[model samples]
Target: MPASPSPLSSPPPSPITPNLGLVCITVGPEVRFRTITRTRYLSFPEEERAGVLHALYGDNIGRLAGAAAYCVAQGIRLYRMSAALFPMLDLEGDPTGQRVLESLSAELRAAGDAFTAAGIRVLVHPDQFIVLNSENPDVVRRAVYALSFYGLIMDMLGFSRSPWNTILLHGGKGGRAGELAAIIPTLPDAVRSRLCLENDERAFGPTELLPVCREVGVPLIFDAHHHVVREKLSSQDDPSVRHFVLAARATWTPPQWQVVHLSSGIDGPQDRRHTDLITAFPAAYHDVPWIEVEAKGKELALSDLKQRLKPTP
Candidate 1:
């Protein structure tokens, strides 16, 4: 029998402070309401229903930009826009995609400008599918090119795309660290600098992913929810979690900003789902500069965070 690797063998410690933040994802079509609905669901107050409605859909620039604006207005300095922008092109197909991309480019430019003017940082969150397995190389190329346009237009770097099932260690036909090392070097310096790697929710954690980042010289982004879920499943102790956070910090140089994924999870016997926004905030409130809450009622969920960060007498 072979000896199982001790989890402690992962990484050492470092100093970093976690800040408050949220992630924005468009939910549905905007609905107009003349009055407030006094129906309470979950922890959100009914009086704030209108705000919730607006955050989810009202004033949206399609889906991606709207979500970005909603989060920024709520004092969330960091926002993650979905990769749906690219797929929207592919789904619509052809010159339709060309038109859609043009329109999206304009929208992203405007949104990026608004965020920049307001001193907020916006990052385009790319899914692994577009980056790793698009059948058409042009699709992948265009996606990256389009994002680079948005990044340049907005003056922000986008999140890096790693294998989706990385949390599971499945390694299903996607680029691993060494593979990514080769591909990343091929991108233009501007594009490469904007790319950031994130820890997956299923298999890998900062401990597992940071070495890849260290080798490739790309910065790391941590999803605290992912780390917690991994811990609960493995029943690891606090020292282990602390060790991973430290290791992740080691991958970054000074004055480097890191984005963290924060969201509450529902612990069932079988698996954890990012249901609420309660658990993640407290655990990560002191570790990083930006935190993106990936919750169902993100805006309302953020209200909780605002209350927490308020100055006390």
Candidate 2:
């Protein structure tokens, strides 16, 4: 395990230190990893679901645990873990997940311990298909199941039910923020405690999600690139964003880590598409605790941003 941070002597985060975050994989020589796809997973015979899921889930766990170690070594403090960690672990047809988790309890416990022990904050973003606010009853039901699964996994991995170990999801169906907020209390403690909402490129921006965030008592992760495109800003550093940043900060529980997603654009004029590397970071983020550098470059982009952010001697 990497070194753990000391107990806070003052306010939870006295210094304006935003730890750089890497999304999913490591690009350079240090590490790289992946998980089984649903299509490939289902291709296997139904009779083999037990062994197959064990292998796939086990492999994913191993990869994540390894990535945690890599983060500690690289001094990267935040990581957005892939949402596909468990595949059919939540499916009603496939109930072998509990057994698989039991079988790998030792590995799971150790990996979870390592992540916490390393003092590395871990989070996950479910795919776009999951819209907790969707009016479609079936869609909402499935979204609830998927989210509950994330909470369960976090618990199994020994993650704290706090914003630091978040299960991030976009606030889709933007206009119906109330419906989203109404569902929060009904959710199990696992999902309720760790769930966070983020502003998306078009549907939900800071203006749309802020009220829901406060109402639901969840943190709001301001995605800089998304906000730039959503609001037609000159750049992510637009002065206007400072207001949004401070407002978003107020939504978070405080001092744990106010997360923001950082990415560059592929097209000019604040395109919603992500590029290989980010051009700049919001000065407003300096006081935040985590900025997830989610670009095509992955960890490489994160490393580049860190280098550029380093103060001159």
Candidate 3:
């Protein structure tokens, strides 16, 4: 009988590769950059509003295109768009806003096309000021407006207002999951369709927010650092870590990469503040495709984490 083939005859298993990316901006390579909004333009003469709006939107769109190009070249497939990209959108429904959107439609479509061709995924996270569950009606309205603005941006990017280019928000106003649940149906379909809820340091954790996400038919973005601080789950091997990680992933539909935000703590009263670089990654995060580093160093931090994750020669 022929000798059994040696185990070494088989090719070594391929190394585990991660699909990783940075948040809104990039550094070092310095491809992604920002544009000034010039809110003061809104104060200019009404007759000049059209010109001002066009200029602002045009400049920002150019910068956005640059950002997309950077992602394509760097193999960074995920990007979180900045909330400030369209300052005029804050004045939603203004004739000027409509003009700006109309004027930039082609450019926006081109940028979106480039992104799609490069296989880059886009996401938007509204600022903390947006709180859907706030008791104040005005606050809630503003929050909804912000979501609408983000929805419009995605629409302009030639993207369907769907979870593919999702809009992420944090759970706010602790224990008010009922309020959020009630408000979800009332939001414009444009906003609700792309919206996702995330756990924050003060208000919600995976355990508390998961049910709300499921009830609203949205996905949850598990912030590992926030969960560790809020739940005090310090160990990387904590059973809860894997449990919640899997739970968050379950909220997303197939073909959508489960997104998680990563950050480290600094010296502070709470020690929960985000540091410039991630010093360590929780082992429980294994197999996660898209991890957005929320460190102050942005892309620099992501580079550091990628270096750490590389297999030793």
Candidate 4:
């Protein structure tokens, strides 16, 4: 966000070093998109429901595949798909969105082929409410079910079950690691195989999450900006930052290149909000293969970061 306050940021070298990424949505050339709230979606008459869903659901699937073609045109190789790609899929009632997804099997396969053939790496992050560490059983159950649905989406896209096609989630803001640890293995294979935990700015930091990630057998993504805000660190090069980064990296293995996140603060170090462009990166990200650029500028931010990170002769 804005400009960096004199941090020693590293340049990216392809494959061995970080490949900058974009979050959901893009601007400049807007993609036609639609999403409905759970309340509004549930209000449709039973007779009108199927038709409404067919149009709405098919529109998103086309857009999802269309994004890959856009990336190929723009020379972008990394993308995180929209988290709500299949709306209301986790509902407990009859219209759980499964039939629609299955009905659109050919479209899903075509979308999968589009990404794979183009070599655009794909991943997803569940919405914030999908928390596993909640004290409420209902919330936890819903979270588990939601995660399974994410895995299903990845499968529909024909993505391999690996952290490379990760279903990322936060460890919750409550700081209840014990409660979260107890439920990791109970998750279905579709989820557990692709799952990754991230440290948010408020409660979970790499220090708080590393042990649990290690214990639960999942990788932890180092969010460089969040760690700076959470710990009130002066720079990204702090030795402790690298120490924890390596510790988190150790939990990951081959096939899934270790992932990290980079961003500058919206105002300064005190703000959790992301700004239009990222201004600095961390030396600790030296070996991270995937660096999701978390910024409000979307593809603009990602492209700018990559240009600045390019090594100059």
Q: What lDDT does the true structure give each of the candidates? A: 0.48, 0.78, 0.75, 0.79
Residue 74 local lDDT, model 1: 60
lDDT of 3 by residue, 233-252 (tens): 65444677778889999999
| Candidate 1 deviant stretches above 4 angstroms | 1-19, 26-72, 86-96, 103-108, 131-175, 231-237, 268-270, 280-285, 309-312
For all predicted structures, in order, the TM-scores are 0.63, 0.90, 0.88, 0.92
lDDT tens readout by residue for model 4, 1-313: 3343343366455446456776768866555567888788779987776677778889988988888888788777778888988787777776547887889978988987898998888889988999888888889888888888888888888998888788998888466988888888889988899989998878788888888888988999888777888888876677777887788788887625788888777667557887778766766676677778888878887777767777766
Instruction: Estimate, for each residue in 191-292, the C-alpha lDDT of model 1 and write its tens digit.
Output: 566666776655456665676678767667666556667666543224555566566666656524655566655553124565543433333235556656
Model 2: CA > 4 A from native: 1-17, 29-31
- Quote model 2's TM-score: 0.90
Q: In model 2, which residue pairs have backbone atoms overlapping below 3 Å?
A: none
Better model by TM-score: candidate 3 vs candidate 4: 4
How big is the positional error of residue 299 in model 3, measured in Å on the Cα after superposition? 1.9
For model 3, give the 10-residue run with minimal summed lDDT.
2-11
Q: RMSD for each model, in Å, please?
A: 11.9, 6.1, 8.2, 2.6
- Which candidate leads in TM-score? 4
On lDDT, the leading prediction is 4
